[model samples]
Every structure is written in structure tokens, then in C-alpha cells.
Target: MKKIIKTVICIAALISAVSCMNNTKTLLPNVSGKAGEVIIVVGKDNWEGNLGNEIGGLLARDCEYLPQREPLYSLVNLSPGAFSDMFKLHRNIVIFNIDSTVVKQGVVYRTDVWAHPQCVIQVNASCADSAIVVLEKNGENITGAIEQAERNRVIANTLLYEESKLGDVVAKMIGGRVHFPVGYNLKKVTDDFIWIADEKQYSTQGVFIYKYPATDEDPFSEENIIARRNVFLKEYVPATAENSYMTTSVFVKPGIKFLKYHNLDFVETRGLWEVYNDYMGGPFVSHSFYSKDGKDIIVLEAWVYAPKYDKRQYLRQTESLLYSFEWDEDGNDGK
Candidate 1:
């Protein structure tokens, strides 16, 4: 039985290798589509039926922590016949294949099928009912996969046009670095706080990095993190109005979740920020984690101020910068 199991595993590995080779394309075109857009390929009947509704409801749910309501993804449906080569190059795609001849009734995820840096997820089922079952079981997984792809694209672009000088300053200040894009510049730098921003005429994307002494208490708790963040913002982040400073918006209580990504455990907070005596406000997301030496709790926060336009893409682009953080190998204590 053990020998049989080993043989089966080897066969599976060989099949996976062959499948990868077949899917890889040389000189693939770059993906086309606006950020936060996804193309869904399905039959007209299926798309108009319960399957389409399910997919739409899952993918089009309102994004969290935004001041204004915005769908998580801008979904575009295309019939199987309309999914031509032009549509195939979209950055995000979901294809539904419902047929009686489908022996493998499951979801298959592939990347860069027809274009570089693309996410293509195909759901195969013997019938429409079976397709819903598969989606219900893996809804969160599907959403997460697409979200990661979007973030990866932003990170890739940031790395390509990175501001290396700002990264060096962050490493020297915190013993870690986050890749800032070309437009962002250092706003302020101090012993324990660093501010960076990409200020445009109508919109502003900002990031704050601050550290405090670690304690044995529940440091990652929502209340504690908010209190600390408010303290930093009130001290460092100020508005044009007299004595006005940024603080957590009490109108919407911030939400906190612990997450482990890229081997780093951190507490994430999402909510809105407002100036104490001013009208300026927008959405913000922060990641609080310990320094490499575990001596300090470092908080990296990204906030957006875009009253004139939709903020979903702006917030996402700035938030992706926080995910690019990495600890420097050189033993700099960030002194």
C-alpha cells in the first residue's frame, strides 16, 4: 500500500509539471485592465442564472473601511464566445465551465496564462448546482487569491519605481524597510517617528512609521493600538487648521484582526481618520508588529485623503507598500 501511495504521488507530481509547462507561454503580453477590475467568462444562461448572482454577490461585496461604499472588485461579465484574445489579457479573470462531461468537478487556479502578472481561476462542474457548491466551499479562498494578485501587481510596480533613499532612511530608523514608490517623499523624520507622503494637487497618500517600547501586556489589543496611534498622530500629524491634528474617527470604531503574512505576525487595524478640529478625513489601514529584536512595537500605517475622487485604488496602492516591508539583515538597532 505504501509503494502504491508513493507511485500515485509521483504520478501527480509529473502531471502537475507537465501542466505547468503547457500553460507557460513565451513572450506573453502584459495584462490589460484598470485596477480593481475582474473579467468573468461564462455562458449567457449561466451568467443570468443563480451562478452569476452568487459570483457577483461574492465578488461585488462592499469594500471595508472605506468612507464611501465601493465594490470590492469591478466585475465585468463576458459570454464564452465573447471572451476573445483581447479579453484574455485582463489582469483578473474567472471562468465557469459547467457541462455534463466534466469528470473533475473542482476549481483550478492558474497565473499568467495569456499575459504576464495575471490571475485566472476556472471552476469546473458537472452542473450549475455543483458549481455553486464548489463556490460556497471556497468563496473566501477565491476572494483572497484575487486580492493577493491585485496587491502583487501594486508591489511589483512600486519596486520597479522605488525610492531607494527613502527605504534607506526607514532601514536606518527602524531596522526594516518598506519600498516606497517614485512619487512619495520623506515628509518628516525623527527619532521614533517617520512620515512619508505622495502629495498631489487633489489627493494625498501618506504613510507613518512609529515605534514604542514593547510591554508584557496585551499590546496588540485594538484599544491599546488605537490609543498609541492617536498619540502619535496628534503629535506628528497636523492639519492647516490651528491646533488641529489627525486622530481615529470615533464615528466608526476601528476594526482589528491578527494576520500572519510572509512569515511576519502582525495586528492589522482598519478605519477612518479625521482631523480633530478640521474637515480633512479619509480611510486608513495600519499594521502593528514587533521589531526584530522584540524590544519595540513598530506600527506602519497608510492613509488616504482624496475627497475629489474614489479612494479605493489610492488606499490600496498605499497599503500595498506596508506589505513590502522586510527586516534588514545587518544588525542595525535603528538607533
Candidate 2:
């Protein structure tokens, strides 16, 4: 009797382990389509009706910072029955359940339903009209979640990349560390500033780090930050033409806001940048915050110049580098 009881307990434990494994498998990192691609799983009949148009208008909106027109996310529609195992692994997805029995129109947000690091939103309604209303009501939340997931992925991939020596180099010079990608290098360095850029054939992206003496505890004002940025860019970042340098465009007023990232308070600035004497410009973003020692203020700026392609993805990839900033404890090597 004792042996039989022990055998039963062992079998029960084995089943429990298997159940846990099954539950955790979907939480594994999702392997799916490229960023900005969302799979829409709905019936074919609804996909061609007014409901489809509403869904498209919500999810396929135009992205900002692009030269031409490009959807924020490309939607690939597939019938519910056809949403096979292959489609289940997508990073972002939406499903519509339009049935009379659903009673009320509603939207649901899910995570890791089929794959790890995945977002799945389901809209259920009694009819096509109700479904459209549901989508219209929750469109912003749906798109915002997708964008946040993409940003998180970018940060994750950058942190997982091999630690470049640039982090340590910057730490030694400026007392701050950033995870610069493998291709970036020190384009220009000065006593109080450093410029790092990744120049491609038709796209050029750069990040500049600098520090200056802080007078008091007053918050950085928009006018003061812009003036300082103009001075620094004029001295360090130059265009291909003679006597031309990068500066914030006066046409579009720069925007400033206070935000906290990675537990550090920073004054965020965003605006269009233009070459003073040249026909070249793009979008730029900066984060200004006080240093740990309270003696200096550090500014980290990221800018892009992609005239031929969509600047949104390029700018996002470059801007994420700023959030990777971390202060080196020992102040020796930024390892």
C-alpha cells in the first residue's frame, strides 16, 4: 500500500510540472513579423464591410516624421479560421468576434496569448455597427500599447548587445554612460562635449552628450535650454557646407516638458532642426537633467537626418539610446 501511494504522488507531481511548462511556454519571447506589423484576425465578410474601414482608420493611421505617407502599422488581415499557428506567433495582433450572442460591444487587451512579448486586442460585439463603435472608443489605447511594446523591444535588444567600449569611454570623459550600438563611434569629442553618430548612405543619426556648471536648483526653462543647445550645436555639429551648422528651426516652436525616466527627472525637448546655411534638416529630441554630484547639468540629445526614408523608425531607434543612460558607480570603467 505504501509503494502504491508513493507512486501515485510521483505521477501527480509529474503532471503538475507539465502543466506549468505548458503555461510558461507562451510567455517565451515571441518570434514574429517585423516591428510595425499587426495581424488582424477577423471573418472575411466583416473585413470587407464598413467595420473593416473603421478598423483600418484606427490602426493604419499615418505615422509622424515620415517624408511620404506610411501607416503607423501595416495590417495583414486573415480570417479567424485561417489564423493558424504561424499567425499566432506575431508580436501584435487584433481579433474581432462579431456575433449576435456577444450582447454588448467591448474591447479586450491580452498579452502572451500565443507568443511571448505579444499584444492581442479582441473586439466583441453583437453587430458590425457596435464593433465599429468599440474600436473607435479604444483606438488610441490600442495603438499606444503597440508603440510602447516596440519601444521596449528596442531597449531590450540594445541592452542585450555586446557591451561596446563607448560606454566606458563616455563614462570616463563625461561621467555618464550610454549603450551606443556597435556601428556608432566617436565622431567628435571636446572638453565638455562628445558627438557620436551612425552615418549611412542616405540616413545620418547622432547623439551628443555634454555637461555644464549648474548655478542653482531652479528648473531648466525652455528658453534657456534652447539657447544652450543652439550654442553647443553651432560649435560642434556642422553641415557639409561652409559656415553652416545645425540649429533648432524657428518655424516650429520647440516643445518642452518635464518627465521622469529610469528614476531620473529630465526636461524633454522636441523640435525640428535645420542647417543654418544649408537645405538639410530633421527632427531632434533632447533630455536635460542634473548630474548625480549636483555640480553639473548633463544634456543628452538625439537627432536624425533621413531625407529619403521615413524618419519615425530612425528617430525612434536613435532616441532609445538616450534612455539607456546610467551613472557609473566607481567612475573608473563603465563596465
Candidate 3:
């Protein structure tokens, strides 16, 4: 069997890693052309063969471009402002997703200075490109794909404290589809989380995983725990039992430190999925860390059916909140 390597990272780590080089900033890169005059056409289909070529030709009929061979985009003569404005105007027109195939919303070229900003980009030999571009890929689930893509773009668009550092982080994701949710008010999230009163010490973040079968198997039951633990330690993998019941994990950012759950039973949500024939419960083993500036705490969590193993992928697939914790500020007030 192929090895399945799983890893988890919070928003803090993401930002910190991306901005690993302290020289980058939130302002858009310098551009050499006009942004408003450009229009970036994302592929509505798997534009691998002649399809992409045809679309490029059709768009070129109206727009002009510099003489170049093997263009990465269908159009590129306009400046950053023009490119971003055009996307905002007709982004909904070409939103498409073909089954098993890939449809891409070409990245956006955006900058703060909208009026006739000089443009500079990758092709420039010695000038800095003052623009930010991001891609939107429509998956098999088109609506969900777009929604997620929008969220990704929104997050990629946000330039917070040391805000300019985000560009470097995204540049690394040049050919990948790692998506993130966006637009929620990111002010100290304080719901379900009662309080964080400690200003002197770092708070804790954690996750807990429990096994629940799709069939009628009580996950919290003692018999189920013993059976699953044996299967995991002896077999090195989770064996599927009847009814399809499986495991899940919950992530949280706490104001105070949390103790390990050697043996604890948690109440299930009042949802249709919770009412099953068999259910088993378990405790939590959390991984804790501090924020970049050390003002906030971050938790690294996963479920261990056996020592040194976690069911993080399962929770991310089923519940969106499974891997989510708090995203705190660096407490850095830029001077």
C-alpha cells in the first residue's frame, strides 16, 4: 500500500512560513503596464488541446498584446488595475467546472493604486512586478469549488500586519489547490470558547478524535474502544466494521490550558447523524504551540487509535471545523 503522510498547520504557521523572509511587504509588486486594459480569461473547460487556443484567439480578436510566443495567459497588455477591474466585472460569466476535468479562474492582478498604475510582472528583466495574482479552480462540485475559490482569493487578498508578507506565501502555491475560507470577521473569535483571561501566559489549542461508525455501533462504548485499539495497534490501520461508522476529531483554541482526556465521554451533537445503533467515545491528546510574537497560543491535535497516529484526514473530509482553531493577531502594531 502507498504511504499516506498527513500534516496539519494553522493560519499562524501558514503566515509565518510564507513570510519567512522579513523583507517582503503587503503592497502589490511594481507593474510595468496598465492594469485596467487587461482581461484574464479563466478556462471554463479542460483547455488542454485546441480549446485553450481557441479561447485565446477569440479574446485576442478584441484585445491586443505584446508580441510574444507561448503566452501563459490569453491576454496581458493591460496594467494591474485594469486586470483586477475586468475580473471583478465579469468573474461570474465564465465560472465553470467540467467533471473529472479542471476549470481554472485565472488569478487576479490587483494593487492598491488603481489609477493608471505602471505595470511590471514576471517577464520584466530588472523591474519589480507590483501585482498579486491568484487562481480559482472549479472542481467536480462546481458551486462548492467556486465558493471555496472565492474564499481562497479573499484570504489571499487580505493584507494584515506585516501584510505584504502574504505574497511570498502564495507564490509558493503556484500550481496547487490548497483552499481556505475567507471574509469572516477575524476579530478574536470568542464563541463556544467562553474566555481567555490570561495576558501573561500563552493559551492552548487542541483537538480530540472519536470513532463513530456509519452503522449502529456505539463508539464511546468500552467494547468498541478495546476492539478498535487492538485492530489499530495490531493491524496498523482502522478496519471498517459494518454500518460504516468511523472516527472524527474536533479542534479548538482555548483561553486556558486543557488537561489530557485519558477517559472522558463527550455528548454528541443533536443531528440526524448522531442517532445511530452503535457509538463509542474517547479522550483527547493535544499538541500545543505559541504564535509568532507569542501573544496567542496554537494547538496541534489529532486522534490516536494507537500511539503516534491520528485520524485528521477523516475529520477534514467530513467536518469543516475538525481542523479549525483560532487565528490570532501577532499583537504587532506596525510603527
Q: Which candidate number would show the highest TM-score if scored against the true structure? A: 1
Using lDDT as the measure, the top candidate is: 1
TM-score of 2: 0.79
Angstrom error at residue 212, model 2: 3.1
C-alpha-based local distance difference test score of model 3: 0.27
Better of 1 and 3 by lDDT: 1
Alpha-carbon shift of residue 85 in model 3 (angstroms): 8.4
Instruction: Show how many residue pairs clash in every candidate, following the order shown.
Output: 0, 0, 45
User: Which residues of candidate 1, in runs, are more than 4 Å off?
Assistant: 1-25, 333-335
Q: Give the TM-score ranking, best first.
A: 1, 2, 3
Candidate 2 residue 308 C-alpha distance from true site, Å: 2.5
List where candidate 3 sits over 4 angstroms from the true fold: 1-140, 157-335
Off by over 4 Å in 2: 1-30, 43-58, 65-69, 103-107, 124-138, 173-175, 214-220, 293-295, 331-335
How big is the positional error of residue 290 in model 1, measured in Å on the Cα after superposition? 0.9
Per residue, candidate 3 scores C-alpha lDDT tens digits across 1-335 of: 12322223455677788787565654543323321223333333323334344434443332111111223222433323334543434322222122223233232223233222222111111111111111112112322332233333333333231223222222122111112232211112221111111111221111222122323245433333434433322322222554434232212211223222223212222111110124432233333333343332222322222112222222222223222222322222311
